[model samples]
Target: MQTELTLNERHLYLHRYPTRQNETLQAWDAGDEYLINHVEQLGLPPAQNIVIINDSFGALSCYLSKHHNVTMVSDSFIAHQGAKANLSRNQCVAITHLNTLNELPSDTDLVLLKIPKSNRHLSWILDKIRNTLPANCRVVSVNKVREIHTSTLKLFEKHLGTTTTSLAWKKHRLVFSQLDASPQPISPFVEWSVDGENYSLKNLPNVYSGESLDLGARFLLPYLPKDERFKRIIDLGCGNGVLSVKLGQLNPNAEIIGVDESYMAVESATLNVKAALGPEFQFEAKVNNCLDDFAPQSADLIVCNPPFHQQLAVTDHIAWQMFCDAKQVLRAKGKLLVIGNRHLGYDNKLARLFGKAQLRQIAVNKKFVILQATK
Candidate 1:
């Protein structure tokens, strides 16, 4: 179903994609509407330089585009694509310039943001805004009413400035804030120790499978190919480049590449790769959507720990996309290795994509299984 959203005195019909296998889930939520409503009430200045962060769909961007000059920031390639598609559908001129977390534009008069579900990523964005914007820049952060509280305010206070939540509207809340009179230097990325490893891991807020290693990833570690004879290796959906570090260790000479949709994840992975492998490690990690830009028949081996969700809804489209993209990028006789829950039926996906899929290992009593597919 499509939603006709009226915001900033303009009405737009935004197309929200349904969650995979769950047709009932809509692409957007009340939080998005609340942000738009709050902006409309502000009677925001014309041609004002406004920035919006974490807009899940085009709802917020499409509305703002009609009146104010806007800049949109998000980490998901799919979300960005959805926003553009919706803009075209509505016959709306793109008002806000869209950018990823890795490339934030400079100072602006106002910032309208939807609180991302990942607290880690939110904190990073807060810190980034604090560091880049002037001391008096205004920021409005909107979220569901149930998500606001003292701790939430404290998080904003810690980096940007004193923050207060507005009264609830339709079970949603907006945070009013300004850059603190004296903002500290951007805090370092949050750091955590990887168990059984000497090197500490660091992360930006939105990176996937953060801090502690993912359960499925942990199970897939030992099964990694023990030899380093492969020519080209990719850590598909590489979060913080952990698997790349391991893959590098296993095949010291093979060229490794890690890719993810989150800018923070790519930054963290780049740092971790250098720290873990010393200056000798040869690899590239960048912000991308499942190798969307990779050339076909290029990679000789691919490793993946595909994500099961995008934002709050669970889905396997990302996994399916990863598998499909891997096939396009893998050379003839190349292989793709993945670890996932047994119930996800990834074995079938692999079989269909590669024509040959085999279970390499399984952890008894655990849902994780490692599978290999060859082209």
Candidate 2:
């Protein structure tokens, strides 16, 4: 596998999970190099406080922290973990305030951002920065040539100020936007409803499938268990808590748990559950990796709409981990309800893990299938 080889004095090794088939030749993308090159040209000394957004791995943070005091933030707990793991693997300096995107730290001097794939999430992030960024803070967003254009510039202009783009380097471009010095009002959190239920979400651009309710979630909604007395229920890999909300509404008495590797997903799900069930509704929502810390035989039901990819790579490692974790945490005869693309053949996985799998629902497009597994 290829790695991010920093300067000779310091380096960080990074890798995406499920190993890319041709990683040796791929290595870090141009976005990584562009950020590094920009820093070098500026001849800037170590920053007092630097905030990094949406760093997929340790690519940007690992390099910047070598010279600057860096605070790494990301929506994905897995990404945060990956960055730290890579830092340790390369023996880099400990990063300060390795926070999740659900909350931003105070006193940031400079910001380095990797433009996220979701525009809505990105807008939300810009809004947050608008409210907190210092008067002199510099925010640089970078992406591939096709990913940046007039629309991207407008997004930054809306929240920050007039933005400009750099000439293309290795087919990647950098977006430069200055924080507005004048005190401006921060926009209210976007209020939207899910299936007629009210919700308030604080999203950042780049959160996986953030713009709308996931289609896979819609297909699985009809199959939500109506088991009223369910003692313990979990939403494994709950993105935005849609599955958990459905489960909570159906089984009001059940103690619902929503777990995701993304801090943003956990935050969104927590908001969704509270909005759907009201303020008194209490449940456990946390940034966790597929029941990694769950106790054995602790759950009676596990509902999941497993993610199919991590970063830019499409792989089933996370889905497999969710299924395996479900099996480990579920008691004998406990059930695992899952939704996934039919092409992914999750049925075979359930069968292997639980000894039996049943098709509960299949969408008309055949793009998704809901499977139930019993341990």
Candidate 3:
């Protein structure tokens, strides 16, 4: 990954994920650069309270903290870990960290937000800021120019007062708005019922497969390993806890855990599991990236419908890391079952980690293939 970020008369050394191996991928993107440059160009005064939302890896937080105290908000566990590591690596001071679901810290004098892909979630966040921040707070949101649309503008206009967009520079655009007294109500949850499943699944605004089951996960459901001997099971990348809830229902004695990086995903998954499998079922859902801190040989079964993309970037590094984590965490003779697209070549990747991986054709689908690896 690129080590040095030089723009707007400042130099920053940053890395994404803290373990990013590719030399070309930089931690901060053009949007971040545009936002930072715009802030510098505006000659904004030192903020009494500066809040940064969706800072991918401490780029905005670290740089902005030098000028003003910062409160960083994020949902990804990996982002927090990476931000902390990068901040320490650069010898920057620590910033207050809060999850997106948590309330904003103090009254915001200025907000620096990075717009995400989910428009509803963006609206939800806008509502949050409108309701939480003090009146007349300065809000500046930045995104790729392509992401700036009618709804984006409308959201800011409605939640904040008199929103305006800056001219595009380096394929990025910046939005400036001043907070108003009117606070709009927002619902962060969505719901859907799956056929043949006994219960409805709940999802938060940013959770994967927002209101419905994903096609890949739909293809994976019937193939879930149902064994009587398994005592511990993990639903890797358990979006909305569908797989974990299903497994828990099938094997009532097993201890089930759902893991994901998104806080909304974890919260939705926990709710979905308990709603589907009754409150008595023992299950846990947590926000984590793959398995950075998981114990070795702890799981008898690991099931995953791993995600291939990280936001707008299409990459398999996350899935590779997840498979490696599964291999390390599974007990002796335990199994890891994964459902992935055929074009992705997950079988070969799984084989690279596990000495061997076997593939089976699950009925009713040609786009996805189920691969199982034994540790």
Candidate 4:
């Protein structure tokens, strides 16, 4: 997979963000190729303010940065890292980076966007574009032809103004839109209250388990390991930091850290944590992949509601990595608790990572299993 990808007469190498696993996933997709090809074929000139949304890696940015001033904006922290890694590997100049939902630059004219899996996410991006872009600005969005639908076109028309599509090329289609300076529109972020948790969780369009408290996490909450009081804790895949907020409130002496791969998740979790712990508490939320940078045996307890997939593919590599990293960061006799779907078969994986692991049947619900492993 490490080979030259020629786009717009330029060559570059790209990889998906690091998985720390053996998944053979390509970094870029046909949509990426289609968008670049469209601009080139149309004789579009490069400009100083080129904004790219969700360029999974640096493929688009690296190739375009040669002439255009590029700014990379995404929600995934891993994508940002991958873009930077590939940029350095290609010896390309560093590009500006911004997390999703951030303020769009005042000089933005040409926008390159990739359609996300979530309609909510796409809606938010479109909302941001509508609020920021100048009249007559051009936005080029692409996706696999299979993903394009009437609703997709409606989003473009509703948010950005007039829109049209190019004929399918290589099973991908490019969307062309011009800013219409339409009336300001609003898209609301979703909010839900956990039934018994006394917490209202806010979900950004792209955060995991956005519709509600994930069933596994909800099931595991009542059974949270309370065998002993812990002073240092980590919430591994803390979706909205609800677990940490609750944990912080319950354990007065504990200092907590919540980490997620998505910057939007971390931001949502941080807000929840603040509302729960106030300003004087010792807790922080950060965007990180597993426990990559944590020192060995630094946590007294680790809690996780691990993710089973990355991007479009469903896989358990992320869960496996999280379990292994939890063991590395847990103090001697420190505990790691995770909630997962019953069919995932995480017990054996945890046993392989830790010397021993136990499965707890904490509920009558047959859909989920809570696994606890110790270092």
lDDT for each residue of candidate 4 in 18-110, tens digit (9 for 90 to 100): 733454778787888887777677676666588999898878888888878899999988788889988998999879999886888868868
Clashing pairs in 2: 121-204, 121-205, 122-205
**Per-residue lDDT of candidate 3, residues 1-375 (tens digit):** 567988767788888884764545667888878777766876867755789899988898888888888888987777788799888987888899988899996577888999988887888888889888887778899998888998889888887768888898889888998876378787778888876777788888888888678998877777777789999999999988888877987889999999999998999999988888888888998888898789999999999888988766788888999999998999998988888889999888887787653434444356888878888
Q: Pick the candidate with the highest TM-score.
A: 3
Which 10-residue span in candidate 1 carries the lowest summed lDDT? 356-365
For model 4, give the 10-residue run with minimal summed lDDT.
Answer: 355-364
Go through the candidates in order and give each one's C-alpha lDDT.
0.77, 0.75, 0.84, 0.82
Top-scoring candidate (lDDT): 3
Clashes of each: 5, 3, 0, 0
Superposed by TM-score, candidate 1 places the C-alpha of residue 226 at a distance from the truth, in angstroms, of 3.2
Model 3 regions more than 4 Å off = 357-364
Please identify model 1 stretches exceeding 4 Å from their true place: 3-9, 16-25, 88-107, 134-136, 184-186, 278-280, 355-365
TM-score of 4: 0.94
Cα deviation of 227, candidate 3, in Å: 1.3
TM-score of each: 0.86, 0.87, 0.95, 0.94
lDDT for model 3 comes to 0.84
lDDT of 2: 0.75
